[model samples]
Target: MGEKPGQYLLWNELRGDWCNYDIVGEQYHGVAIYGLLPDDWSREGFETQRMFELVPEPANPHDRWAISVRADGKTVGYIPRQDCQSWANVVRRVAASGLIAMVPGRIYARDAKNWDEWDGENDPPREFASTVQIKLGDPDGALPINNPPTVPYTMIPRSAIVQVTKEDEHTDALLKFVPGSGYGTLFVTLHESVSGRAASAKPVVEVRINDERIGQLTPQMSQRFLPMIRHLASRGLVTACWGDIKGSAVAAEVRIDGIKANEADEVVLDGEPVTLPALIDKQDDPETYALPGWIDMAVQTGARHSYESQPESTTSSTPAAPPLPPAAWYDDPQNHRMFRYWDGLRWTEHVAPKVR
Candidate 1:
């Protein structure tokens, strides 16, 4: 009656025929008849047959009224209603396995079957699954990506030469020679630990010769003395000798030799007297003095005036003129009378009296 509730009939365009089918349950019902001419089929040919036969006489009491279709009698499509409740279970399994493909704006027959296959090659190979091919800009030559190498150094020898000696009780240290490429210097180092501490911390004597300075314990002394040594050595006077005296009084006397005869008059020793020969050697009136070392002592008289009366002659021959008041009465500034009156041991307080 109403198209047998769930039975369906259709024309196959590829096969070119009206097909006859019944819906019994999940399985096919009575028999399917195909290749029916559309003009010869009754208006409700298969639908009228299924409602009376398969709907009322199912294989089991619960077998639903359903429609099944076959391409060449292998059942491929179905629809369920009424007595076939298990037909719903078959439709759910087909939907999960993707038996149907839905496209928008298209309609499909209720009994259309979906067939699709999946081969395993669309996935990556197991070994290379974790890797990917990344394209860098371009390829260059293979260069090392690590560290570099090392170099070496050389050493040279120093050039200054030095020597030390003892002259008398003092030390005569020398900076003998430096190389021609001379960095001309020699440092004289005295370890204070080895040489005992000085009795007086003050420098007793410090001297420098050649390119070396000796006996300088302080930095200020070394700076002042070392440059002096360099200057002296450059002048070719490289010898510096000194004497240390341990006595209460240290005196030095310098005797200048080979002095000219005229020059000797100007040489005055602090406490010594100048002799007559020393002075006469420098004078132009050489013949007026007897010997260069002697003094002329002869006395002369002046001519008398005849108009004046002469004194009377007496027995003592003028009474000796009272001894001329002794030559000490004449105050001659050039006589050096104070030296002449010395008694060989000490000076006398006597001075020659002034005379007109």
Candidate 2:
């Protein structure tokens, strides 16, 4: 808020993630991990639908979001400070992670006509970086739209290679699909159970291969992952159930196929939104909105930071999360034909069509 200070603590509650912040001059200052663009980024000229990414610089200790800008098949520059917040919010609301992680947005170009001025980490980046100038809405791209029928959507595997290890503990527990010793594709699905008490419980997504349910991803991991998988399924790109095993003790105790990085879209596949991801709760299970930090100024009152509903519940040992809600197929807000399970307190990764 002052002096474009070096990256400072700036917490966002919507995506349920925090990062450092620093302002730029005009104001554009500093930079983030650089991505190189095609030489023609300065050649073919910037156009409509040029994409951008909100990359968090966690190592900076200043939580700076370098609005990664891309054009003509290359990641160009970044969004200048004045425009970042507004666009970031627009992308956050609709996305599950709520961090502007990677929804499609664009920027346009008006005054600049250059071919080599971008500050990528590549050699001679400073020469290009110094010549670069970005203004608000320049090379603007369309905001995210619903899965429009006319506009085709398809899945491009987030990772070219996904290596799943079969030596997992659950792989042994479920004996049906695990590789005998070597690694193989352990096809898992996002599962929901209607087998138990109907009204008294709602089941979460279990990671199952063959017929046996060996284990499940953590609640938070499942929640973050479900939307992306659904979006891909809608496009017919992803065929596996949306499943990830992280964000809780289940991540530590259970052995599922391992992903190399954190919060990766392992293709059942693909997605953070900004403002700690707004937790969705109905009238009955509103999570306690508690804050643990302090405000720097007198005018800024109330809690300084917030957290999402506990990632894990008390009775987490069993198949269901604690205090399971009445088990019934509830409406899936993301899709009309399918319904999500409102397990009382939270939405489970499970979804089925009302007709199904």
Give the top-scoring candidate (TM-score). Answer: 2
TM-score of candidate 2 relative to the true fold: 0.22
Q: Scored by Cα lDDT, where does model 2 land?
A: 0.29
TM-score of each: 0.12, 0.22
**Tens-digit lDDT string for candidate 2 (1-356):** 11111111111111101112222321021111112223345432443331233332212222232343322212234455565544443322222222223323333222332337555554532111212332232111222111112222221212212222322556445443322222222234433432237675534345554445566555444453455545555555422321222222222222332222222333213321111122212122111222112101111011111122212221111111112222333335455454454443576685543321
Q: For candidate 1, list the clashing residue pairs, or say none.
A: 23-66, 23-67, 63-83, 64-83, 64-84
Evaluated at residue 262, the lDDT of candidate 1 is 19
Estimate the TM-score for candidate 1.
Answer: 0.12
Off by over 4 Å in 2: 1-69, 78-188, 191-206, 209-212, 216-241, 247-356
Residues 1-356, candidate 1, lDDT per residue (tens digit)? 01101111110111101122223222211112221112243322222111111111122233323323222212222333542343322222222222211100100111212123224446422110000011111001011011111111000011111222221223333212221222212212221111236773442113333223333324432332344333333443221211111111221111111111111111111113211000111122222222211111111111111113322221111111100011111112233221122222333343322111
Candidate 1 scores a C-alpha RMSD against the true structure in Å of 74.0
